[model samples]
Target chain A: MRSVVIAFIAGTLFGLGLTISRMIDPAKVLGFLDVAGEWDASLALVMVAALVVMSLAYRLAAGRSAPFFAEKFQVPTRRDITSRLVGGAALFGIGWGLVGLCPGPAISGLGLGLPQLAQFVLAMLAGMAIHRFWFLRKGSH
Target chain B: MHNFTPYSALIGGALIGLAAALMLLLSGRIAGVSGIVGSLLRPAWGDWGWRLAFVAGLVVAPLLVQWATDKPVSINIDSNLAVLVSAGLLVGFGTSLGSGCTSGHGVCGISRLSPRSILATVVFMAAGAATVYVMRHVVG
Candidate 1:
């Protein structure tokens, strides 16, 4: 119960942050990505500031054996720089550049009652399903 | 740039970071939206509850904010259906293949100094810039 409450509050904060930062606006995202055009360097600060805070959080977590409401801190342990990572990131970037939306922003955007965003979300789910069925099930990892 | 907003950007970013911080310190979970949602596809019986709750909060918060503030969440997306679909497909497929997305790898992973996350961030940022350049310059 505590874990669920914390997750919900964290998610709410995240959604609010995305909204206030205008990261949910696809046009703004594209502008940030469009380095050749009138480059909006605003979004870079989002990453920088997020990094700063998360870094501190990581430091705090390092001192503790477990989370307040959970058994252990679930962090990714993979260290290899694999082809799959690079390839998939590149493809994801292409998609991001194409639509100027990511999973977080895109999912949050659904609340605004945008038909186009709904279509994108549906297609995104389909794509995930496809990957799950084809790549994941086939032991592609 | 007319749309440049450093103050809001930083504040919003800090809030996002705080959110991640809460998740890590309280729930011992990474606040990576893509990873969270992806895992739901094959949820362990005991693990899906928080994920669903988190997603519900994410999807509902904006509505609550709009109601409270009378300021709807601002959003502008591509009008073309086909392009939107294609972009969505690529995003979903790629994020799955990569094992993370912006929040996962970009914010959480990079902050922890994960080599893979750093490399992934660089690759995706470069790819995004290059794609934008190509679409606006070469194609347009």
Candidate 2:
């Protein structure tokens, strides 16, 4: 119960961060991507700022033995490269370029209640379902 | 370059970082949206509350922010429904295949200095860059 609450709070904070940063604006994002034309560095700055904070937090947290909430950290074990990985990256790239909205920004855009967001979210969910049932399952066998 | 005020971005990033840290401290879980959302679909024992709350918070927090700030948020989509759907499917498929989304791996995982996350971030970012290049340059 508590953990769910914690997760919800975290996600809310994240969404707020995206909104405040103006990351939800696809034009701003596309501007950042327009290196050859305008070379908007705002998004880069945002990324760097995020990295700096994350670095400090990790340094402090690592000194401790375990996380404050659960028993221990939940890290994945797989390290090898695979097709799903490459394919996923390619697909993600296409999506980001086409719409200028990734998962985080897309969710944030939902605040506007735009029909496009609904379409994106639904398709995203369906894609996840397909991968979970078909690809991951088949790959494990 | 235009005159840049990084105050908002910095403050926002810090809040997100703090939120991620607090979530870890309080709940021993990484602030990964994909994992959280996935867990909601086929919830395990006693996992419904937090997932619902987390998603609920996502929806409500912005409303609160807007109410307080009165900043109008406008959403514009250049593509059609088909494009949006295909794009969403691709990202969803990628998230499952890669084992996480940008937030899960890119933000939280990278914060932990995980090697897998570093690699995943690289691949995903590169993929995004290339896709953007192709879409805007070649296809368009």
DockQ of each: 0.84, 0.60
Off by over 4 Å in 2: A136-141, B1-5, B43-45
Off by over 4 Å in 1: none
The DockQ of predicted model 1 stands at 0.84
- Candidate 2 per-residue C-alpha lDDT over A19-42 given as tens digits, one digit per residue, 9 for 90 to 100: 777777776676666555555666
How much is the lDDT of residue B43 in candidate 2? 36
TM-score of chain A of each: 0.96, 0.87
Query: lDDT per residue, candidate 1, A1-141, as tens digits?
Result: 888889889989998888888898888899999998999988899988899999999999999999988889899999998888998999899999998988998887787899988898888888777888897678775
Write out fnat for all predictions, comma-separated. 0.81, 0.59
Q: List the residue pairs that clash in candidate 1.
A: none
